[model samples]
Target: MRGLSRGPPAARPPRPPGRNGPAYTPQRMADVSAPEPPKPPPTLPDAEIAALREAGRAWEKAPGRSSAGPEVAPGLDVAETRGRPGEHYVRIVRSQTQGFEPVAPGWLEATPRAIAPDTDFGRIRRRLRTALLGSPLSIHRVLHERLDKVRALPVLSSDALSSVAYATEQIVLILAVAGTAAISADLLPIMGVIALLIIIVCLSYRQTIKAYPQGGGSYIVAKDNLGPVAGLIAGSALMTDYILTVAVSVASGYDQIQSVFPAAVHYRVAACITVVVLIAVANLRGLRQAGNIFAAPTYLFIGAIILTVTVNLFRLITGSIHPTGTSIHIPMTESFTDLGGMVLVLLFLKAFSSGCSALTGIEAISDGILAFKVPEWRNARTTLTIMGTLCVVMFCGITIGTEVL
Candidate 1:
């Protein structure tokens, strides 16, 4: 049969008026073309169709599909259009099955289309996505590989650990407001207390990891043991904590940069935004890239802080340093203070609460156990332990350094 062109057919002369004002001649119109018969759908080999149909039967019988039935039709994949007029390119279908000799998922992509894929917008979209995020990965390529303890420490803990960059700064800033005397007298004790708090939190999480090997946190614990409302509250609190971490980290980082080049102080907002964007883009590239990119800074910060503290400790032990004196002089902000015992405690507690915000990012590894490699839970727990140990050391050292140096 001839194909009907998408363009209009040949023009016809107008019908002439008759005695009845119009003609009604069905028989005369027989010369005109009739609508074409519908083409039967293309099919696969009987054996292949039978296997697929049988395989899809359970899926077809599932609740949502019950009304429409299996998408497979009369032993045809429907998607397969070979042996029909539209068939052109070769079709390569990988058999879907489990067990040994697993099929590779590449040369495995296909999408049923009325037009060719290369000519479709899908090409442009895929290309753009690839340009932005590297090559596309097959769904099968997702990993369960675990991180070793050293690598895991930074990969899973960078966010929480970044707080070390500014936690002490924040504490000192707050304590300085009362007076230089007030800061010198109270800063060490408050910081030490906060460091102790960090250790306790880390130990508590260790217990939590062991107790809930499946990775239950405050939300799950609250839900399971304390009911849904408590779980919701915990989740909301966590969200708030994360938001504050992002904001405070950026703000404090801005202050640090400002210290080095005070002129950049005005650009703080823009710089912070750029950093956040870069972080988001890195994370979007996947966890592997993120770990590679972020792990260095975390360790560098730890190494620098630890090294500086060790020097101070050596000096203190050798009687070459006085703990009462400040190391690098920090210009004091103008402030007044005539506080007594209880008011001082309140001020210190408030500062500690702000510094404790560093703990916010610790939940990343706990919440993401499945992202770890083989023996997922065990590796995740090990990572958590290492991170906790690092956090303890860093917190204690920073406090001590600030106190003595």
Candidate 2:
């Protein structure tokens, strides 16, 4: 291998004086080039512009005519028609870009007419509903629709207050099974216990209102404090109570009706359903409306109860009314005293449970605190207190009235 020393490599070409690769001219480009002045929007040629004007004038003269005019621009349907008196309107029905076309000099722009709902029945239904329930209120109107305490007391307290009507009857029915002796012996004590319970429950819920102003009742409180499961259980229990309350109220109401109009007993089921539906419809109309619907009767009933109780008390004080001498003959085998302590205790418990129905709607105020006017929690608390006091008075009065009258 002959070493042909190709002469030492020619000296490497020097990089131009800066760093390695290319020499830096260091010419600074402008960081942001000035934005090109916006191009003037394209305009129609004078011929086309003049034709459009002429066509607009022609359309104004014969506004009723429809035509496929001479093609000026592709997909431009030019028609001459009256729109607003002085201004030109153009409606581009079709375009390649599928974009809004500029209003031409003299054409009318037609707006599509509104399509109605599919069924006449729908309109009929809506009209009928409005006639029945009144027009629906908007969200902004919710505050206006809120209840004051006067209205709220009847609306929310109806269930509780109405319970007083039947509560005494229920207690008496249970006691009557054990005879008048058991009734005379047991009614006062049971009434006292129920009255105390009402106070405790009412006070508890007032605190609940204070604590949870947003107003979820037991469900919200339980969920936040205990857990979701507990809240669900509480909610379920409330729902069950509501259902039973409705059922019991309707049945009891119909019973009274039947007593008044004996023929109504033949239509008991129909009558009960009608009452339930009426109540549900009233409530659906909005709480304020329901309050109005119920207010008169509720107050009347309250007045009657109060008057009856007052008169009874007065008569008793004056010694004008003596205790009802109605007596139930008990068998020697089942004498009142022979009824064991266990039997008496159970009977009292049953009577107490029946009377506790008076307390059923107590939580309604707490649950619906948001429905109250401003200072919802405070109004709610005050309403709860008032409701409780009224209930206590009414319950005790009714119980005593039952005994003496």
Candidate 3:
């Protein structure tokens, strides 16, 4: 045993006891330990907090993270920011204050600044002004120059007056279809009703114009008075009406032209397209310039109708008038009784109502009240009166002419 024994076998130093006894130490106990918790971030200074709030506000107003802030004023820095916490920082730099700048002071309150004298900017500016405010010599100008135009108005008034021509045609067509006899009896009453409706519409639109001087028209009124949905409906209806006006006016004009030049009878679409192009060109030229060009024709058209009606009225009262070619043997449609009496009357009424199309432009003046010059309300009012009178006269003349013929 002494010869074969290992040194380690002699050194059995310790053995762990069972429960409650001392335990043996492990050699690798210190290798893997639990980590400690992290520390909190540093607090921001008062100046940094204020700067952050201001930056946030600026970003909200006009979103960007640049250094620019409010305009430089006395003891104020437009460009300055507090540095991060626990870091070096720079305060807002100070500057001198500059007072308010006038957009336009004397000539017109905020008159648009004139463009460069040598550049096309002048022409563009002039065109823009003309489109928005109208020329000094045109009906549009007169409307813009006075507030009364909002109530009574001119260019749109003339448009209303022009409606009489088309309105009478609609009535005559309705009556002729109903039978020549029906026309002779109902014509005057129908005219009276239509006239009454026109007046009502005019009055309604006048109130609308006064209430909303902005150009939203029916859309604005509906939105303000009714709600957004109603405004949308009004807007859609107006757009539809404008489209119909273009189509109907051109088609009717084409028919008139065809009567004189039978060769053009088949070219109705072409004529309509031409008229649309012309209108677009006019619009592109700017409202004021176009108004200047159209003023003479508009007035002449009124004058012509007035002169013709006055002469015709005198002749009719004196028993010397002769009917025109179309009026002499006016053809009546025979499809009325076939459609049933009640249905036909309803149809005629509907047509008569449609003829009230003349009243469509009545609100345009009011919508554009802001377009007028100084003393806006007064200018608008005067223009409105002129428009109303002209419209009344023109409507009456056209109605009577249709009746007499």
User: RMSD per prediction, one decimal?
Assistant: 18.6, 17.6, 18.1
Candidate 2 similarity to native, TM-score = 0.70
TM-scores, all candidates, are 0.68, 0.70, 0.61
Reference-based lDDT, residue 141, model 3: 45
The residue-by-residue lDDT of candidate 3 on 310-337, one tens digit each, is 8988898899987677744445465655
Q: Please identify model 2 stretches exceeding 4 Å from their true place.
A: 1-119, 325-339
lDDT of 2 at 109: 33
State the lDDT of candidate 2 residue by residue for 328-375, as single tens digits: 554323654686777778888999898889889888999999999999
Question: Could you tell me the lDDT of residue 73 within candidate 2?
Answer: 55
Off by over 4 Å in 3: 1-154, 322-341
User: What's the C-alpha lDDT at position 383 in model 2?
Assistant: 90
lDDT of 3 at 44: 92
Scanning candidate 3 in windows of ten residues, the lowest lDDT window is 107-116
| Candidate 1: residue 195 lDDT (0-100) | 69
